[model samples]
Target: MSPAVPIPEDVREEVLSLAREGVPRNEITRRTGVSTASVSRICGGPDGVSFDRSATAAAVQARVVDLKAARIGLAASVLDDVQLARQRMHGAEDNRAFLDGAKAVAALAGTHVRLVAVDKDDSSDTEAAKSMLGKLAQALGVAAGEDADQAEDGGVA
Candidate 1:
């Protein structure tokens, strides 16, 4: 058998840091240039460290917060577009201008509707928010893994 390679302490610590931040093991391996086996061993091997789930929960919450901010900014931009379209329509001096402005307003309104829609099955952000909620619950010890799964299915958990 080949001799085992010894990973430096700093590298192992980096691996643990990434895991605590909710980074996947494969991604940690890729980013740190470490072997997958080494990364896994550092993360949760028999002698490895058990990290605080709260760090992961915090990371997920941050992502959700950032996503919400981006959506708000986009909604504002769409509203501005709609307002411009309305002004153009009102100030139109000819039939063609009015028609173009009307079309712009219709398209902007549709985009705004889509941005604000919260259909769970069709919205990826809804799913991400749900996942963040479950992770937070788990971190807070409010629900075990199976209980969280049941809660997602609409059963009491």
Candidate 2:
């Protein structure tokens, strides 16, 4: 048999992290420049670490909260734009300018409405994510207060 090739520490860690995040073995191999057999060896069976789904769930929840905040901010900006467009439409000096301003108002208003529709109170989901994250930290022997503080400060732990 040929001598075994030693994978780099960084590459091995990258494979492990990708696998934990639910990346397919082939995808991890492609991303990390690791061989398929090596990727499989690093991410499968008893010798391999199982996927950390709790981490993924927590990440997704954090992302959702961030997206909601962004949407609310975008909606506010769109509303401001709509107001400006309406003013411009009313003060337009020509038919073409008036039509352009009116179209801008309509488009901005529609965008604002869609953005507002996506903004919601996800307090329950936030709480659940916090709870799950705390549990995961506990399982990993980490201090819960540290992560809790991070969560309260709007950072994902």
Candidate 3:
């Protein structure tokens, strides 16, 4: 068996300092010639250190859930605004502009909905956003469907 390596007091302090400075444990091990496992033990291990990986991960997951919920709420609100805009454009001559704005709002709402779905499914937020955006764009093409030609030329009834 290899002899156990002792981390000197000064080296320990340096490692702790580097950890506090946001250097990763692996990097600290490389710089200090300490074993990666030892460095982790000294800086974040159960008995020697205060860092709690499980707690940190739980907190991050909670935050993500909160953010995703907020995104969904914002999307719903925008969709409501779009509906109101459509209602207000009734009997108005500028139906085209109003309908265009409503379409934009719907697109944004669809994006947020997809984002929330992604979060619910445990996908990365960035990836979810991109996927949702693509889906929203495609969905928008069929948004008006059979009403398209009529809505474009005819004012809201």
Candidate 4:
């Protein structure tokens, strides 16, 4: 019989890296010149090998999604607070509080968009957020970009 095919270690590593990067098995096989069976064997075997860079990128993307969701929720909460404060406003101080809450809502909205961009790793989201934030800032008559920066810096904006 002819000799058995042996998978090279470098090719195995490349396949594992591609897989971790969300590349499909067949794609990895094509890119790395490895069989799909070998790629599966390396990535799914009991040895538990991993491609750390791609795994970490995936994790960061997941966290970005979670953060964006939290930011949207927070924006909704701020809107409610603004409405309540507006209803209870008795004077200029209360009006200021309402404005501040509005600013908070805008900031959170910007953050939500930014997180979405980061998660997708796409410039399109960034451009969309910028355009949306500009319109929102104009409608709210507040400095949303500054507010977003402050919120990100203070961890509570």
Per-residue CA lDDT of model 2 for 1-157, tens digit only, reads: 9998788888888888888788866778789889888887887755576654686699999999998888899899989899999999999999999999999999999999778856646788689989999999787665667788899999997
> Backbone clash tally for model 1?
0
- Which model, 1 or 4, shows the larger TM-score? 1
How many clashes show up per model?
Answer: 0, 0, 0, 0
TM-score of 4: 0.30
What are the RMSDs of all candidates, in order? 19.1, 21.5, 12.8, 17.1
lDDT of 1: 0.83
Error of 4 at 74 (Å): 0.2
Per-model CA lDDT versus the true structure: 0.83, 0.84, 0.73, 0.70
Clashing pairs for predicted structure model 4, backbone only = none
Query: Tens digits of per-residue lDDT for model 1 on 40-66?
Result: 778886546554558679999999888
Those runs of model 3 whose alpha carbons end farther than 4 Å from true positions after fitting are: 1-51, 98-102, 105-109, 120-157
TM-score of 2: 0.47
Say which candidate scores most in lDDT: 2
Off by over 4 Å in 2: 1-43, 46-51, 119-157
Candidate 3 residue-wise lDDT, 64-157, digit = tens:
8898778777777766765766566563468687677667667766765675566464557669889999999888877666467667878552
| Candidate 4 lDDT, 63-120, residue by residue in tens | 9778878866765675566555445443336667767656665665565555445436
Show the lowest summed lDDT stretch of 10 residues, model 4: 83-92
By TM-score, the better pick of 1 and 2 is 1
- Cα RMSD for predicted model 4: 17.1
Error of 3 at 11 (Å): 4.7
